[model samples]
Target chain A: MTAADHAGWEVVIGLEVHAQLATTSKIFSGASTAYGAEPNTQACLVDLGYPGVLPVLNREVVQMATLFGLAVNASVARRSVFARKNYFYPDLPKGYQISQLELPIVEHGEMLISDADGNDKRIGITRAHLEEDAGKSIHEGLDDSSGIDLNRAGTPLLEIVSEPDLRSAKEAVAYLRKIHTIVRYLGISDGNMQEGSFRCDANVSVRPRGQQELGTRAEIKNLNSFRFIEKAINYEVERQIDLLQDGGTVVQETRLYDSDKDQTRSMRSKEEANDYRYFPDPDLLPVEISDEYVEAARATLPELPEAKLQRFVAEHGLKKDDAVILTASRALADYFEAVAGAVDATAQVAANWVIGDLSAVLNRDGKDIGDSNISPAALAGLVNRIHDNTISGKIAKQIFEAMWDGEGSADEIIEAKGLKQITDSSAIEAVIDKVIADYPEQVAEYRAGKDKLIGFFVGKVMQETKGQANPGQVNQILKAKL
Target chain B: MSLDKVKVQHIAMLARLKLADEEYASSVEKLSRIVDFVDQLSQADTSDVRPMAHPLDAAQRLRPDAVTETVERDRYQQNAAAVSDGLYLVPKVIE
Candidate 1:
């Protein structure tokens, strides 16, 4: 809910995001961690929790987690233990899910998010711990029984828990987006919400504005998209507020958001609220990370979003807003840098064309920057034509459309279409002379101090030359002649 | 430490065990005695000692990130009592 809807109450929200680590195999087994496969094909004996099988930690998982911790400036625990959280579910072939309880890998991490007020706010990360994901249960297409697919069992996940610091659904989304950007920048996770690689569960509560204690919190789970996360948290906040105002107390339980109905309904809570007796796993010893390991991971950390944004502004001389937009994705930022670096024009021109026109076409075609039809070099070529006045900026749009349609380079398009700007002083002066003769009334109005009619004369000159005349030269000539 | 019949019944339910009504009394007695026996260790004053999870004083060994397992779904499913399309079927647990 919006902060204004709180109605003399304070909204306390914390988010727990589970990101699937980009690993080649399961955390404790050698089984493949590929997303789609035949049912139960990827699950190994250790993944299935077979008897007498012991788990060995994956080095890459720990290294990836360490990289994330370093990226967020969190402390990498010298030693962390894996524990068993006992529960019973059909998908869990093992009676317990191995998770971290007291000692997690990373803690006290914070990230800056532009709050609802669009100011820098640092949200504290309570902890990020390593855990194994559970298998999937397919209830559909079965007449009376649910089928279990263990293919996703024992996948490595880093569950990041945030402090109860959020005040609005919008702020919560900002925090989530910041985390997504960080993980993708770190290259530890793909951050693909569609494949359940990154998912969020929001713990939302509200209390009187001046109250020190928190209200009973309801945990909303399985929100995959940013839109659903915002809507679900807002819906939950409104529900809790309405309940408390009606003299009903809020209950602490897990909720699933019904996107179709745009409402949240309580799932069975008794079994979930039952005690999960956590005990350290006896089979595996405590994991101990070395300072050398952390240092090595730190060295591999590429320039993160903040550093990239600053570099784009300082080195490329782009505006802060454009830098932020380009730095949202690593590939997009790289694309911008490539264009900016290769163009004969100012980087700001590259930024404008990339952010304004190129992004519009990409969004309309439902294509990612990676799948763009126009390569960065080709785009730079197009920008170069406008920069050197080989083509007017207006004609550049036409050249860009041709380039997107695979009509060769800008020079080739200009040659084939005869779309060169009329930069020769004689040619432009001739067009301006013709336009002045054609639009005498506008010329008279312009000389009579209707200076805005200069646009009318300029348009006529552009029409006479088929939009090839240099706009600045035409403006100067028209103003002097009038 | 003591475990009552209700507590034992709750534990049975948590573990998904079907306990007969008469079995609760014996389970509580045995469980309480076991807890009491373990509780005797609490009498020692070792608050300064670090909690140990495993007996071995070794760190967890890490395996390299590599997929060595191949498709053994046919051999694995042979142990299942019922399966359709390589999935383990269980009674529907509708909420």
Candidate 2:
């Protein structure tokens, strides 16, 4: 069958992002929230559901939730309710998790995502509320007994829901990236994927664009990487399209993305709302957020990534692509700004070096800019050396390579290696004279009006000086002798 | 909402549960009650109200472009029932 008409088929994508709140202890208990702790040692009586235990809402968790709401420009509910979600698993010693059901702390908001073309798309935020996490189930060896890890139990999780506003896998990834940036900028979560600090569950559905009837949607769970998010959604969309083309109806259910196979497989029949038997949690009291609290959180929010990206373009004279690359992460953006401020001689040059050479090295080495041996000041020092002609561009590249190897400062490396550019016309002229005397055939070729011999002469001079001679001086000396 | 015996058996198998006949009879009755209570939720006039997927209204968090961990394959596979050449082994049903 021909691909579903764009005018007819519409892809509705909603994301449920789970961010582990940056807290030292569990949400309702004093259990350590540290990752990679010995399996059950982190568990406490409260986390293990001992009788007579009560869940005291962590104040820091509330503040973190409020910070996220303020960052998203969402409304903070004056009062919210926590409810128990009932389910059975070996990892869930409590038999139920304390989650917000009826009333959530944060309400509706919108996130503006800019596409590659600089067009802004607004993704709708439904709610962001706090909940305690369930422990993990490790199904490793025994067929009859699965290992249980309670380290994650009672961990504070802020589950953010989005409206089905994303239309493509790329948009879904962009939305995830924007959310990731905002949360990290707000300092609410560490957002580490490998540690399961931040995870995504995507709800994907394909429907006729103008059709009132909605197609069944599949929820793809536990995708942590942006690449996987895009690939999983794209694959799911194709699978749904193929099923419909083969005269099959899409089934609504939860599925797991097999990253190795690059496919989504049905996990189980999707649970409806009533399955959980959700009711107001009696052990906890209703959370009351004051106007002052919301206002304070709003005031404490730092400038968001999108705002910083815009400022980078408007104020720093950076290209949109360069701005996007620099502001992709707060660390990278801060590093760029530090270097840019140091070398105000040219902002574009600074951006180019960071986004081009620096990014290339980091990507090639599989290291983040923060992990590079070249610090912001050191990078700025190298750029300044180039600008002041203390080193040629080629020499600067060589120095940068050494700097990345954890060698001492740019100046030290230049001095130790004797890589400083020789800009003196006399020095260049002497080398050029030796080259003209040695290559008489090239000299005659130049005298016979073969202008290309000039290039040969310049190359000879640069070779004689071990790439330390200035290209401009060599060009001037060669042209003068010819 | 009635949990037929076949449906009960199917759910149990899907869950990888091996149940006795006596347990199956009791579970069917108990599960029917639970399902009936859940079916009542369908009666709510949620036509206008949007179904909420999560309680919170926040976005995803991103990590720095750095490697934070390394999974030592041999050590990780130590817990597996069977492993070979950096791979986990499972019973082959295809053959």
Evaluated against the true structure, the overall lDDT of model 2 is 0.81
- After superposing candidate 1, which stretches have Cα over 4 Å from the reference? A1-5, A437-450, A480-482
For model 1, residues A1-482, the per-residue Cα lDDT tens digits are 56566778888999999999999999999999999898999988888878999888999989988988888889999899999999888888989999999899999898888886679998999999999999999998999999999999999999999999898899999999989999998888999999999999999998988999899999998999999999998898899998998899998898999999988889887654459989999988999988888888888999999999999999999889999999999989999989999999899999999998899898998999999889999999899988888998889998888887789998999999999988898888887888788878887888888988878888888888999999999888888878
Calculate model 1's interface RMSD in Å: 0.8
What are the clashing pairs of model 2? A127-B56, A127-B57, A128-B56, A128-B57, A129-B56, A180-B60
Q: After superposition, how far is residue B68 of candidate 2 from its true place, in Å?
A: 27
Steric clashes per prediction: 1, 6
